[model samples]
Each structure stands twice: as C-alpha cells, then as structure tokens.
Target: MSDNGHQNVTMITCTAPVNIAVIKYWGKRDEELILPINSSLSVTLHQDQLKTTTTIACSKSFQEDRIWLNGKEEDIRHPRLQSCLREIRRLARKRRNSGSPTSDVTSVSHKVHICSVNNFPTAAGLASSAAGYACLVYTLSQLFGVDGELSVVARQGSGSACRSLYGGFVQWKMGERSNGTDSVAEQVAPESHWPELRVLILVVSAEQKSVGSTSGMHTSVKTSDLLTYRADAVVPSRMEEMIGAIRQRNFAAFGELTMKDSNQFHATCLDTYPPIFYLNNISHKIISLVHRYNQHYGEIRVAYTFDAGPNAVIYTLQEHLPEFLQVVCHFFPPEVNGGEFLKGHPVHSSPLSEELKRAINLEPTAKGIRYIISTKVGPGPCVVEDPDLHLLGADGLPKKNA
Candidate 1:
C-alpha cells in the first residue's frame, strides 16, 4: 500500500535464479497439484548469469488483472497463472483471519498488473519457467505480506519452480500426503558448501522447445513403464548416494550420478509411445566430447546433463575450466570474434592439447553451439532495492524504457 492514499499504487520488484536438476523430475503423481512421482535434486546457478526479473503493481484504479512476459502482453486468465495468484491471496487471507499482525492490510482487494523479463534469451532453452514462476511467487508474496514456505504455492505454477526457492544443493521431496501439503523443497547444502565447482551451459540451439515439460512429462507418465521403475526403485537410493557425494565433495561420485540420471531420464522419454527427442546432433557430440575428454585424463574431470531441450550443461571444477573451455572453443568457434561466443562468468585462457585433440577426432561443426555461459553456484531469490530498477510506472503499466 502507498502512503499517499487508497488510490495510490504499490509496487515491488524481485529477481530469481534458475536451477538445473541433477536428478530430473520427468513424471507427476498429480497434475493439478503439480506433485512429482519421484524426488529430484538440483544446483542453483548464480543470478548474475541466468535469472528472471519481475515487477508487480497493485492499485485500486486498475480495472482488472493483467500480465506481460518478456515484453509481450499475455492473458491473465491462464489456469496455472490463476492458480499461483489465487493461492497467494488465500494464504494472505488465512493469515489475516488468524489475527496475525504481519498480514498486509491494504491492496488485498486491488487488481494487479505484472511485468516480467528474463536476463537470458528464452530461445536458449534454459529453465525460464523455473525462474519466471519462482520470481512471480516471491514478488507476489512480498506484496501480499505473506512469508514462510511459499514453495507449495510456487509448485502449482511449475513443479521445478519449487526447487528455485533455495540455493546451492536443493531437493524436492515427493511427500506421501494425498493433499500435497508436505511436497516442498528443502536445502541440502548452501552455496558456500562447494566453492571450487563451476558450471558451463552449452547452448546448442536458440529455438523454442517443440514439446514443453508439462505436456512431455504427462506423456511419459502415461506410456512409459520405465519411468515408473526409475521413479520407484532408481531415484530412491540414488538420491541418498548423491546427497552423500555432495556432503563429501566427491566429484567422481557426484559426476557419475549426475550423468547416469540424465541418461535415464532421456531413456524414459524415448520409451514414450511416440518417443521424444530433446537431444540433437550437437548435444550428442558434446556428450561424446565429455566422455573422451574424461577418458583421456583417466578420471571423470567433467560431466554433462540435459533437460527437455538440446542445450547441454557441463559440471566441472574451477581448476579444469580453462582446459575444457579451450577444447570447446577449438571445436565450436564463434561466428564473429566477439559475437555469440560467451556469456556470464569469464574463464582464464589455456591451450588445448594436441594429443587430446587427436583423441576427440571430430570435425568442427560451425555454429553448432550458440554460446557458452560460465557460472558457479549462487543464492536464491533476491529483492532489488533500487527504485530506478522497477519495471512498472505509477499507472501500473510497464515503463517505456524497461
């Protein structure tokens, strides 16, 4: 609420980081509630590299709810969007009803106008929804003055969005409750837990995904029996072992589990009746490069993981970044000297080896990769205190220059 009067608009802006799952969530136990069939784990990347910035304004003068995503106006009546907005309001009402002093008194009945933008291009096939919905839920909670465990509400927007509520190593526990009350995300370790680790995103294509995650996962649940086995038998023990690996800072164990789980998830996608192919020639080539690179070194120095898209995310230590990056730059050179080559954290220069190049033995594929983002583990959602950074104007509309 604004200090001027009831007619005044109140606005808040926030940013949320993206999370890449090591243990993927491929199926759902319940679609409406967005409950997963199995638990999953992920590492939250730094907000400096990939993130969503959302601004929400509430005012009595607004006629109705409106939303703009990535500079384009969108329907506010979308079912998933409505689910997130309604759940936040309900929590605020419940807190007020309980005579809690922390509940927001104003803007409870005012219509809202939301504007969101992503730092990275949506065409990169990164986890945009994971960051978008998480930012939406976090910003809305700030406006509604509701706190404590908003992951359940965030999950309604996207299952993976729940994991974005925390930083570093996170686990989305598939709770046993039928009502989905206990299905929440918890932090397994903080970002500072592993300072030497780094992430590199190999953008294979900047095209929108042919199949979205929600629809794709639904198909897998219905047609793939392997999904049932992996969810029931494989993920349980794997989750425990992965946690131990993270705790002990064992790169070999952690890297192995990450690669295998990613492979199994894609295998389940193939087992679907029509079969979904998220990996392209570029993705397969990157996988081969990682394998041969590790084989030549006589150790697992790097690992690769893919989601429901062609992009490949590589996990390795900081000491290995320079050499591996040089290997990548050699095979997939940028179009222009400084164009579409790299984004995010910069890596130091290191020369590629002739023997290793011979071992890879693959022809250069020009522009196979759009760019590479070098980053590391980072914190979760954050509020931007600078007033000039706000995306909306006083009239509850997107600013011209935002």
Candidate 2:
C-alpha cells in the first residue's frame, strides 16, 4: 500500500529470520538458478535474535531501480539481485495481465528502491543472505499483490534462502527437473511442532568467511569425489530420516544426525583440492566440548553444527539448556561480565555440578567466543504493519538513519 501523503509511492517493510541447516546444502547443480545438489533441512531461528529487515518502495516518480544494503548504496546490477527483481516484477506483470484486481496498477509500472539491513553479522555463515533475500522476495510479493510458491523465487537469490521462506523445520528439495521447477522449499513442520527445541549460536567470529559459499560449493563440486558421493548416495536417505526425526520430535536422532552431517560436510571441504577451511581452533574446541558433555551424560544433551564459518550452532531441548549453558560458561569464559556476554533471547541458566565439570574436563578458552545468541524455532517472513518500521521514507529513498 502507498504510504500516506506520498500518493505516488508505495512502501512495504518485512522481517525474516536466518535458518541454520542441519542437513547442509553445499553444492549446486544449476548455479544460475541456485539449484542445490541435495535436499537440506534447517531450523528457522527466532527473529528476535537474528534477522534481516527489508523495505521496498515503488514510485512512478522514481527515475530508476536502486538498492541500499545496511545504509550504503549497492549496485543493483548484481546478478542475484537482478534475478530476484526481474522474477518479482515478471510475476506482478503476469498478475496484472491476468486481470487480478489486487494488483497495484500504478506501482507495477514503477521503479523500486530497496533497503535492507541485518541485526547480525553478514556473510559470516549466519544465513544473512538467506534472510535478506527471503525478506526481499516476500516484501515485493506483498507490495505487488503476487502470491503463491514464493520459495521458488527466493531460491534463485540464494540456495539456502528457499528454506527461510517457512518457519520451523524446512526442507529444500533438490528437484529432478532440468528446469529446476520442482526444486523449492517445503515446511516439514511449523514452529508449533517443536516447543521445547532450543538453539545456542556460538559466535566465534563476526568477520566475513575466507571462502564464500558460492565459490566453495563450486570448487567442491568440481574437485571432491566425497561431495559427489554425498549428493548421490547420502543426502536422499538422510533427508527422509531428518524429516522423520523432526516429526517424531526424537531429540537423540535429530542431534546425532545434525552433528554427523556437520562433520561430514567439513570432511568434504577437506577433500576438496587445495581445500577450504571453515572451522578454526575455537570451532574445533566447541565441537570437542559438545561431544565430551554428551559423553559425560551418556546421551546427546547438545549437538553442534557449523556452517561456512567458524560459528557453532548448538541444538538441545529446553530442559538441558540450563546445564549446557553453564557448561559453556565454564569452558569458554566470556571476557565481558553479566548480560553483555549473551545476546538475543534471554535464557535461564544453572550452575554445572563440580563433578560434571570435572568429568567433562577441558581448559577454558577465554574470549574464544564473542557471545552466544539464544533462540529457537520461529515464524517465517512477516510484513511489518507499522509504517514507522519502514526503512524507506516517503521520498522513495532510504531514511537518513536507516
């Protein structure tokens, strides 16, 4: 809808959360379309902790299409950005041609100004692009009055983005179609399906990763036999099993699969020619701590998974969060005291037993982790009704403070 007082300008704002893939999507079959080599499952973390907010403003008065990310002007000609813009405008045109009454006729012909910002670090394996692209596609769809199967559009922007279109457990199906029509994300379960599930994101580093996901995936697909084997033989069965575990709410099965898949994904990275390194010393230590803690309890109390960066995402049930968090504190001892060490959702913690600490026994890595983000399953993209939340002002441009 057009913002009041600026009759020629229509603005929309939306927010979307980053999703951590439990079953990773590493390689691509179609780079242009962003079709993954295998289906992957991910949990949509709560937006209160980490998310992207995007605003799209369409105005007939605007001279040309433009974009701003995190307050700075960015080239709108980037292939991925163009892909999403072209697809959304095409869908809108089709809707208008089909005589859809809901289509905004004036805005359909207008150029758009896009502004996007993330609360968390970008390009740091935190799924910032996934949330950003998903937010863009979603906000544009709403503004254009085009709907239905938007994950298809989001996928072209980023392979993992398709999964961010839905909340809770999601699966990005690596479709068999050469055209990639069937390769879209489907929600395995809604956020309500798993109430007790909790997530702790160990922010080992906020800096951009050494290797971007696109380049790394491309290199791995070309050089690693392990990647090919993983795509062909491993992922299919693993996808089905992951879906079953999520539906059944089987913590042990889910946690084990998450950890194993993460390890194997890194192994494939190692198998690549010249190799790619995502995990650092702190990441390895976090993995060890998780395994030792699980061993001490003789169960999968917590499981850790790393993306294309050093940050570790740990999954566990609500009941185990207190002791697990306490264990993390004992081991990684933050430099900042009190609430500054933790960000995002507030978590109640308990002190680890002295015996439990002794059994898990590890040297505390002071300041190894920047902070921990506490979150859990949350909803997908949502339109912000409050115009005050819009990143763009009435002038069809990013607000000064944005």
Candidate 3:
C-alpha cells in the first residue's frame, strides 16, 4: 500500500512457527553457510502457540536497510542478518533481470525496514532464531515479490531456520557439497499428518543461557570427539528411523529415538573441552520424572527432549495429556496462579489416580517449572494480509511500543 503523496510503501507481514528438533543439530560443518554436521529432524510447533511475527517494508524513501527486533532496534550490520538481506535482494534482482517477477510493486534496489517479534522468549534455546529468521526471509520474499527455494537463504541466517520453513515433520539435510548449497531443509510430512501428537513446553527458566548455540557448537566441533562420532555414526540411521516412525505414527519408536537422541546431543556438549551444561538440576529431575512415568506405564507413552537449554519439550498423544499433566502438577506444584502457569491449548487437569501415584513416588517440588505451553504440529510461514497486524507502520518504523 502506498502512503499518500509519498513513494510507495510496499509492506508485508508474515508469521513462522518454531521447530523443536527430535534429532538435534549441534555442530556445523560450515559456520558461514550454517550447514549442519549431520542431518536433523524437527516438529514445527503450532504458530498459534509459538511463532515469530515479522513485518518488512520496502521504499525508495528509506535511507538504508534497518531492523527492529521485539521493539528494540538492532544493528543491521550483523553478518548473519546481512547475509539474509543480501540473499533475498540478490534473488529479487535476479527475478527482475529475468523478467519473471509478476509484481513490480517494489523495485529491487529499494531499501527495506524489517521489524520482527516473537510470541515466546528469545535466546532461551526455544529456537527463537529459527522462527525469527524464517519469518524475516519469508516476509522479505513477499515484500520483494520473490519466492522459491527460500530455505537456503533462511539457513544462512540460522542453521535451523531452514527447518522452520516447513510444517510438521521436517529434515535439514547435511549436504555433501563444500559450498553448502545442498544443505537445505524439506518437509517430511504436512502438519495434518500427525493430529494426535502434542507438544508441551515446560518453561524452566526464561533467562537467556550462558552459552549461545553457535558458540557451543564451535567449541564442541573443535574439541569433542563424541560430537564427531555422533554426527558421522549416530544421526544417519536415527534420521531414517525417525522418518519411518513419523509416517507410521509409532509413538513408542518415535518417543524412544527422541529421548535417546536428546541425551546423546547433550553428552556431546559435556564432552566439549571445559564442558557446557545446558541442563540444570530441575532439568535432570524432569528427565527422571519422565522416565518414571513411562516406566510406570511399562511403555513409552511420553517422551522428553531438551534443546541446549533447561526447558523440556514433551511429546505425547491427546489421550495421555490429561493424566500426564496431572502427574506433573502433583510433583511440581505451581507456585504462580494456575491460570498463569498454563498457556496455549487448554487441557483438562485432573488428580492423578491412586494407582498412578504409587508408580511415580517422588517428592514434590513446589515450583520447579515456571509454566507450560501446550501446542501441536502446525503449518509453516504464512503471509498476513491485515494491515493492522503489521509490526511496522507506513512510516517505515516499528509499531510496537517497546
């Protein structure tokens, strides 16, 4: 939409979902290209519960490319940020040169104003960068009227951002190419492929981790032998097994692989010289709680995975949600208001059965967890047509008050 008596303000808003890797991506083969050492698979969480909403505007009136994240302006010169912007504009120029772009609403050389915000906590190992970069690239593609094979561009911003390009089950292939063009992500199944499956995010702490993922990965890659072995020997078979499990809807197989892979990934972190401890005391207890709960049922009805943070992401079917949640509430009683503790898709909370209580005989912790966010598999990035929803106003500035 063009502002009155001014150059056209071509703006677009897009939201992208966060993906939790079932088979984690820890090391990068090429840091500049953001290529993973091994392929990893992830479940794209429902955007209604967790997502990054980004608004991008292009105009000749703008002086230079700028960005605002979560209402705070960020340096536009950051390398990864520059990479995404450069790649998208490069694609736009290519389209313009080829006379293939259908929309000339915005010119290739126009400067852009990018504003992005997340519904969840940032830099807390919740994959905020994944969704943030995905939305940024996707929004830019719409603003510049360029599309096709965009996961490659998004990957340059953040390695896992490529996986966020798809819904439900997705895999980031660790391509063999040295230039890293083949290290792209693809959807293994649509969001509708897994309806019964649910994801519960246990927010242990919202504080940013002491070690960032990229830093940890570089340290682990340079120092940890276990990381190398896991990348070469462990992940290939698990990726195949994970794909088959997702296709067949085999919870038992799926849950085991998820937990095992998470464990191995963290082990590699520990093996890093000087070591990196992403999990805390509460994280360990949650892991134990999950094992005891599963042992009680004599089956893997639930699975827990941690991604470079203290938070635990639980996977279970709808049938077991109420019961498992009841168990969680019993052990880690909410210190905050019940309403405040649980967010996202509402679930029925009931008392744990006496029989189940006998099985998981652990002392209760008053507030080991801060809150719970219940979400499920959902679609990938989507454009928002509503002008009111744009994070940036027509003046090429952030609409958010923060």
Better of 1 and 2 by TM-score: 2
* lDDT for residue 60 in candidate 3, whole number 0-100: 84
lDDT on C-alpha atoms for all candidate structures:
0.91, 0.91, 0.91
If scored against the real structure, what TM-score would every candidate get? 0.97, 0.98, 0.97
For model 3 the local lDDT of residue 282 reads: 89
Instruction: Name model 2 segments beyond 4 Å from true.
Output: 1-6
Separate clash counts for every candidate: 0, 0, 0
Please write out the lDDT profile of model 3 over residues 85-186, one tens digit for every residue: 899888888888887738573567888888998989999889999999999999888878888889999999999999999988999999999988888899
Tens digit per residue, CA lDDT, model 2, 317-389: 9999988988888899999995798887788879778898888888999999999998999999999999999
Query: Candidate 3: which stretches are off by over 4 Å?
Result: 1-7, 101-106, 400-402
What does the lDDT read for residue 347 in candidate 1?
81
Ranked by TM-score from best down, the candidates are 2, 3, 1
Candidate 3 lDDT (Cα, whole model)? Answer: 0.91
Candidate 2 TM-score versus the reference: 0.98
